[model samples]
Target chain A: MSGRKLIALWLFVVSVVVALMGFWFMATRASMDYWVMAGSLILISITCYLSGVHHYLTTKNRHGRYIILYGSVVLMVAGLSIYIPDVLDLRPWEIYTRIPSDFFFSFFMLIIGILSSYVSFRPFHNFTKEGAQSGAYYIIHLSIIFTLFPLFLIMFNIITRGMGGITWEFLTEDIVSMGEKGGVYPAILGTLAMISLTAIIVLPLGVGTAIYLAEYARKGLAVRVIRTAVNILQGTPSIVHGLFGYAFFVLILFNGQKCLLAGALTLAILTLPIVTRSAEEALNAVPGELRDASLALGATKWQTIKKVVIPPSMPGILTGTVLGIGRAAGETAPIMFTAVYFSGTGTPSGLLRPIMALPYHLLSLYRLVGYRDVEPQAWATALLLLIIVLGINLSAIIVREKYRQRF
Target chain B: MINKVLELLKEEKACQRISLPPGIKAKTSGFSLWYGSTKALKDINIEIKENKVTAIIGPSGCGKSTLLRCFNRMNDTIVSVRTEGNIWLDGYDIYDDVTDCVDIRRKVGMVFQKPNPFPFSIANNIYYGCQVNDMDVEKDEVVERCLKQAALWEEVKDRLSENALSLSGGQQQRLCIARALAIEPEVILMDEPCSALDPIATAKIEDLIHELKKDYTVVIVTHNMQQAARVSDYTAYMYLGELIEFGKTKQIFEKPREENTEKYITGRFG
Candidate 1:
């Protein structure tokens, strides 16, 4: 009916012809399988061109013909996939696991997105809302792929490289060969002990500071100074904290002994600001009307904070604490400078004694980079560290949910 | 509508016929309140009779709420607020050095304009006042008596463990009332208690207020002049941090006490 309509019809016919030719080439001329992938690129254009013709023919009516053609194309792809149609060399999973398929997967997605976008941008007769939205759809599709790539690649690499070192024996036995050929039992126990003490040291102190800042402290000079000080503490690097722990706790407080208490206290100081700030935000969120209601019922300031304000803010407090613990778990610098040793003696026996920790164990293995056997052990150690942090976070959420007020 | 009107009229007659004790339940003499340099309540004097409802009606920010807060010393919680006056609650000057605000607050319960229920179970919210104060009453009896008094017992009896926020807005207000009642306070102060409610819920709270006046001295601050006339035996009209008029509810509504009071009630300048 129109020049645009004629061109759209011609493009649709050309895409179908290309796809048919490519399919024939794949089945008969098996050496030229690259044509099959080019066919999928053409197939994406079919959804685009059909959608335009659909709108043109229907105007405001349902595009029955367009939907029917679109369904057929999707079904055709599904049917072909069963026959192991190697679009972009996406062969059967049984065969492609060893192949470097990342680039091909990304490339296929890009080609499909570009073709779909071209189709979606076509108008029925003139510019419309759907035509205007097609550009946005293409960008969103690409952005999603880009965002997922790094996460997918990292997780894939780690799991494949790390799982080999895991065994029942590896988890339960102590270091026997200068950190190489044994379980991380003592390190695991040390991490647990240090973090347990860290939690104990931080909760009362952090929550108390949060309460004072959020609920009790007036917005005065004192509060402003304290807030600035907290920001400064958070901005300081981990290595600096580790150095300070060495200077103050190891030398001055514990008389030059590297102990679990010193390391745990160092971590406590590092996380206190995060705990206080997030907990403050949570406390501030409890509605002022609720506070007034409590006060009217004769609950004093401290009483209201204890009962009404603190209970609801516990989830936020625990979340911040969990995040801090996650950072603490992965940090080797603080523990290395203050507490951890390359080897251990009976789980350190007490907080006063030096002990091995997971992160430090990993660092020790890294020093033995000449030994090829230690590389897998390093990867497994990292994976275990991730699991340990994730486990702590999961349990914190469970505990937080148990106490969360359904406000 | 007609039945409700007739019922309200009947209740009004009953409220009028029942003789109020002439004894003063609470009084503020030469009371003035200031938030920093800005005065909130000018030198004001008012008498609250025992077992009677006294309504304070005014435009927004007319110091009506400020005066209501004075009865229970609820204003003491605010920072940099200065008060120069003597407020006596049940024969005790509550602002004197020997007086404790906590003790004062425990004896004088308050219901806020918006329903403010703690995000706890219904039973817990109702009994929180008693438990926190460590009152000697049995928990079950306190729950039953207070909820029944607030006219919310039967509706919530089966679901006492459900979260209080799950209740309807009016139910939450009634729950707040029950919460106050649980403490068995001698005086109950309500600050625009029905402003956030719909007409039907407003009617419910008004009815509960009428029932509440028999045992507790009730002081309510409302923007609705009609609400004051419907529920209170006495009305105090305030404007711009000053007491414009204080008289019997009928005399204040029908007769001229002050020109400003007449203008406010007749929909002139607030």
Candidate 2:
């Protein structure tokens, strides 16, 4: 094997070991030994020197040159700091001796390990196709790892902190004393009712708009204007939608009463752009040839859209609508002003009455954290809200996969 | 160029010794089409004989397919397309303001260049036209008759419930033909029907065209000269949006009528 390949293998092994040790220390909170720190420092300096050599061998005009330069300078500073007191002839009482924390040692080892491995795997002097490909593959894998790390951390934190509050009773009762004592059955029911109503209200409006845009509308000023309006609606904040619902649906339409209908309408408005855009995409995905064939077969425009166009796009339409409904289920601001009550309302009785929803209930519980004992219930509400949203999204994916068309 | 084309038409009309079968299924007079600002067809006039195969032959962008689409009013779907002409189906003015495009399309069915079957089962693909037309017929009977007419029954009869897209390209085109036939149209327009198929599949479609002309008037647009000669009783040669020549396919291919027609048929020029 070439010397470069050998060094690559060594770097790979050292990176794996250091990463595993870092994870272990993070998990166990174990203090690292002084000798281990000293050994890691020696390894880091060697890695810096080897990376600098590889940088010189590869190319003079590359980004890796600066990394190696900075790495060596940082290593020099760390080395000089360790001997500064002895060189100045200062007593132990006069100068403070720094002790390397486990996190710092682990972090240093990780950075050095990444630098060495990157320097080692890269070509020594000339650029070949395989070298570029391997470099791309390494960077892509690193990116994937970085991307997944935050999601895993978030899920881990939520499950660990929120799992204790989930009991059968907690799931089946009502909130008591500002959400300090009881369960969240009413809130869950209210959330389901609101989102279901939102889906009902939005599906026809959104899909109708999508059909008009995709199959009927000519590409002219009217279409461009409507498309621009939909895009602007999509980019508008949910809070603005909430405020609009509060002003229009609550104050004007309902005479300033917060009601379930107002909340659903607000959420429908918020998700309409999403559903419309996706449904239009879905409708557009049905090839024009199919429409032409239908028209050639003597089917009228409406008949062709109903039979030939809609069936193939049904999966896409449903997936988009379901995703929009999922967003509606978790949204807090849209309902806070228009529909939900913090307590007292047991469950959804009618469309005209305000009801307690999970997101709003969670917000209420969070507000009462120090004044009352509602932290566990707040975590539990968050967990429940997450579950509902994820469930809706999962079903959307399942439906999409089940009914996906080839052409 | 216009005078030369008119002279050829005049000469051909005067020397019409070869007797053709009676009955005009469709005709166009002073027909022209435009796509936005670009004129696609110019003063196209031809009579498609009933129960006979008429092939339109031209190079690419020569408006052969455009003329065929005008027969069934399929060009109406394109928003930017504008037409200034009159087309008649069965001696009735189809382009009249009172005429319904749906009824015209029912009388004139079209098969596209590329096969486009709905994302449906093979049986449903055939039944789709019948269902859309609201024809009160037995589903199995219509499916069998149409599939047999397209010569795809034996291969796909046992798997009628399978998705139509699972079929090969040749089979899919035949299925589209069957779908068109299920509507029971009096005329069938095919636009480069074999362009996307293999040689064997092309031959099969040519044979199918020959069989179809016994019952329905078949108008086909093709780039291949030999396919036109093999299938069409009458051929119309178009170039650059003008109908250069229209006559018996045998005479057009074998004898010299117009220099441009002879040039195109003899592989001298498009």
Candidate 3:
């Protein structure tokens, strides 16, 4: 038989072995502790099969099919041992959650897996071409499907939890009471203010430095130093940045006080290198031909930059800003140092008054979850925070897409 | 008496081409240029007659584009670039310390080789140069006159509001030409303007060049020998950053004075 036919046969045999193993795993007691391991094995087997590596590695004159069968049996035994060392030790409560009663998914997956593996690995007898008709495209499609599964799970979780607590009051009213009735209005407003101030500080300084490096300054010791500083800045940990922000902005600048300005300033410093590097890349990406065209058309260097280069780089600059926002919103350690706690009366009397943020609020709510008074409130707050962050991220993507359509 | 008659005929023929009365010259001077420590153009002297096409033909890296850029002081923007030259335009030394490079550029507009129309409407692209240079003009009249002068009014009349990028490559180049013309420059420098265009588009540009000589003194750098011969009145051929020959296009193509020029024109070496 041709190599293609042999490979196809190997794929079929391997899928059958995996399907059998999955069946064995599902058929075992529902009180098993090896659920994660079983899940992982199933994923690995599917990954190998779909990627077509399973066929390539095994079956020497159908000897490879035997290796898969042996490997799956060993894997299934090991997975069972790892998850559930002793069936006698299994708890009665664990039985309910551990074993899924509906075996339809496993069975359905087995059929689909057999069909797909056979279809993808099938040999073409009529074509004169040597070697397998490259399955790299299918392999990529499988990889994408694998990656999308986790993202889909996350989205589903977010929507199920998030939509429950999201409301006008949740978005706009301040968190007045301690538990459930309190809203994230102050936290939302605080985040907006923090981000806006960060932009105000970062944009000019970052863009100016980028311009100086890209356009004004020559490649020398100073430029190298600046570039190194920027790379280091980008590599610095968020928690380390939090420490620096506390030590520098909160303590040194404001005399050991946390204020809105302090938080914004810290975030700005954190965002500066990112913005500079991104803006420099954007500026560099502008074709030299465009600049030459503008200059030849009697535009001065400044005029050329303002008219041609900036407009083309706007989309990239916006992307950098979005990434910076992502970093700013998710950070809890920095806010813990610089700005935490929401005043109950209303929005901060001034910039100096401390403000609450969604991430910290979620953390507080999570800490209070065991308490009867705050458990529901905690869930509601977590849901609201997720919604806000998601909204910001999605809008940024939309804005970037709008500009990309022009190109 | 016979010698005087011959001289009179020669003067009359020069008048028909150059247009200026006796003793009045368009512009001529010593020009030396540098990019950092590297001298690009050295002690070059040439006269550009009013209302005539002067083609600068040379191999790559010979500073043809550099010399073209000097007319508008575009090199002034380069921090390391310097010039020890006298470039007089209408009896004014353009490189005088007080001369504004911006104003000089407005007067000496340029069209690049590849069509580099702004990502804007055709109308906006044409009006931008004028709006930048002459901001006080009555908008409609300026736009109409400039479009007519560029020979683009008829073709682009209906689609003036359309994006410049939506036009064909040749049309974009013409829009770029219209943009330069709108500034009402005394000279227009074209740096291998048709190099990026198709043959038909190139032919259209050559025809436009013939028509442009009536109102603008055009200096073009072209790699196409046939293009230089067909379009220009005078051609200066350079090699390795040195001027090898400067003469009528007919003489440069038909009977070059320099051996190197002969070799280059004969496709021996670039």
Best by DockQ: 2
Each model's total of backbone clashes: 1, 0, 5
**lDDT of candidates 1 onward, in order:** 0.79, 0.84, 0.71
- Give the per-residue lDDT digits (tens) of candidate 1, residues A96-208: 54322233333443444344334434443344556447646756885797699888887778778889888887789987686677888888888888888888898888889
lDDT of 1 by residue, B1-270 (tens): 999999987665441112333588888789899999999999998889888999999899899998998878888778988999787776677777567778888899999988899999998997788877878878788888889999999999999998999999999999999999988899999999999999999999999999998899999999998899999999999999999899899999999579999999999987
- Pairs that collide, model 2: none
Model 3, residue A6: distance off in Å is 7.9
DockQ of each candidate, alpha-carbon based: 0.51, 0.69, 0.30
Candidate 2 lDDT by residue in tens digits, A18-76:
55665566567677654464465456456545655665575564544543565575465
Model 3: CAPRI class = acceptable
How does chain B score by TM in each prediction?
A: 0.91, 0.91, 0.87
The CA lDDT at A243 in model 2 is: 98
Docking class of 2: medium
| Two-chain complex of model 1, DockQ on C-alpha atoms against the true structure | 0.51
> Number of the top candidate by TM-score?
2
Model 3 lDDT tens row, B1-270 = 999999987765441122334322344456888888999987777777778889998888988988888888777767788888687776667777766777777788898878888876788777777655556777667667877777778988898788788988888888788888877888888989999899998998899999998888899999999999999998899776667789888998999999999998899988
TM-score-wise, the better of 2 and 3 is: 2
Which window of ten consecutive residues has the lowest lDDT sum in model 1 chain B? Answer: B12-21
Interface RMSD of 2: 0.7
